[model samples]
Target: MNEALWALGRGTGVVALLLLTVSVVLGIVTRSGRPLLGLPRFSVTLVHRNSSLLASVFLVIHIVSLFFDSYAQLRVVDFFVPFLGAAKPFWLGLGTLALDLMLAIIVTSLLRRWIGRRVFRVVHWFTYALWPVALAHSIGNGSDGTSVWFLALALASVVLVAVAVAWRVSANFIEFGNARKGETR
Candidate 1:
């Protein structure tokens, strides 16, 4: 039973990693135009949304399974109460903060139509902070964080997100610049 739980935890972690990878790839590839391999534009958006949901689900499983696994010592408080994790408090708190921010994004997303686009857009910016915070958490508390496999995956995820963010920011700046130029003329 203990072994089963540990296996489940490990499996969840792997699934979470895969989902994150897929989402990041989809995000990066779709930035320019449509994706290959029969992937629809909406499909990319769906993949990003569903992958995030799956990642959150797997995170819950991973945290729960830690309680059952004798190897990884984790407490429930370490999740809700930031800066209290025995293993790596600073890193763990970051993970908690990421989760909180993700939740906020999710809530605002669900209420997008009702909340109005302006409000939704503002809240959505929180996701930008959430991604790096999650990466930091993974690096800080992850048992295999320093391993070649995990390191490669983490680096790829971080780089893709950074690129996407830069692209989006530059696009906004260009639009703002054009708007200002038009106003001046």
Candidate 2:
């Protein structure tokens, strides 16, 4: 039973990270006019939304499995509060923070239409922080974090986020430059 829970925890955590990575990348890439995978422009948003939801589900499963796993020795409060767990509090706290941020993003997104676009966009930007915090948690507490398989997956996620973030930031800078030139002219 303990072994099963531990395995489930690790498996779900990795899967969640993968899904989150894809969602983050798509969120950035879809802002551009170019269609992805020859799909309709609208399809990108659909995929991003679905991927994020799936990630959230997997994250919940990971947390639950770890909480039950005797190996983890996680208390209920530790899951909610940051740094309260016996299983490496600092590392566990990162996961807690990530979860909190993700929940905030999810809530704001759901209320987006009702609240307003500006608020939603601001909250959504929190994802930039969420990905790294979650990654740190995995590396610090993960049993297989340093393994070849995990490293390969982590490398892929890092590359995806890095490329997407760079592209997104540069795109904004270029637009700003163009706008500034227009203003001067």
Candidate 3:
């Protein structure tokens, strides 16, 4: 049973990471105000929102499973606090911090209409920080962290995000240049 729990925790953690990667990439696409994979802009936004929610579900399962797994020895306080774990404090703490940030982002997003776009956008920006912190936590603390397969998975996630960000920046820059040229004309 304990082995089952451990496996569950590990599997869910990987799934959550993949889902988060998808969410991040889709988010970048949404912000670009462009369709992705030939889907309409609205469809991309919907998929982004749904993927984020699914990732959160997987993250919750991952945390819960680890908390129950004897190997982890996780305490309830450790769930909310960072750096207090007995083993691999720094790595586990990064995960805790990521969780905290994710909660804030989720809350702000849910209340976006009431809180206004500016405030929501500011909180949502934490996603940028959350992704790397979560990735570091996975690599630093995961049992398979050093395995070739895990490293390859992590590398792919990073590459996808990097490409999306580059595209977004270049697109914006070109738009800005075009606007400047129009002004000069």
Candidate 4:
């Protein structure tokens, strides 16, 4: 029973991380205005939006399972406030902070239309920061952090996000270069 709960918590946490990784990569790819994975623009955007929500759902399950797990000893307070836990304070705090950042992102995204596109764009940029924080937390705090499968997932996520970011940066530079050429002409 306890073992099952522990497994559930760990599994959900991993799933959430993967989903979040995909969401972030998709976001960067979508914003780059380049064709991604042979998918159309609408499909890419839809996948990005849906994956984020699914990631949030899995994160909730992870937290709830850990909160209830006798071994984890996580209090509700520890879930929201950073660095107050008895176990793995620093890493757990990072996780808490990541969650807080995601919460802000989620809320602002929901109200994006009302908040205006400019503000939404600014807030959406936080996903890049959130990804690294969440990654650090997963690596530092996960019990299976060193397991082969976990390591593989982590490595793949890092590569995917790195590639997406690099692609976006290169695209921006190309656009800038073209604009400079136009200005000279």
| Highest TM-score scorer | 3
Model 1 worst lDDT window (10 residues): 168-177
lDDT of 4 by residue, 74-117 (tens): 99889889989889999999999999989989999999989999
Q: Output the lDDT of residue 44, model 1.
A: 78
Give the Cα RMSD of candidate 3: 2.0
- The Cα local distance difference test for each model comes to 0.71, 0.87, 0.91, 0.90
Query: In lDDT terms, which candidate is top?
Result: 3
**Across residues 1-185, which tens digit of lDDT does each residue of candidate 3 receive?**
88999999999998999999999999987887666878998999898999999999999999999999999999998888999999999999999999999999999999999999999999999999999999999999998888999999999999999999987776364435566456552
Candidate 2, residues 38-70, lDDT tens digits: the string is: 987689989999999999999999999988888
**Quick one: ranking by lDDT, best first?**
3, 4, 2, 1
Q: What's the number of clashes in each of the models?
A: 0, 0, 0, 0
Model 4 residue 19 lDDT score: 96
**What lDDT does model 3 reach?**
0.91
Q: In model 1, which regions exceed 4 Å deviation?
A: 21-40, 170-185
Tens-digit lDDT track of model 1 for 3-54? 7887787667667656755665565545535453678768877887788788
- Candidate 2 matches the true fold with a TM-score of 0.90
User: Candidate 1 vs candidate 2: which has greater TM-score?
Assistant: 2
* Candidate 1 collision pairs: none
**RMSD to the hidden true structure, all candidates:** 3.8, 2.3, 2.0, 2.0
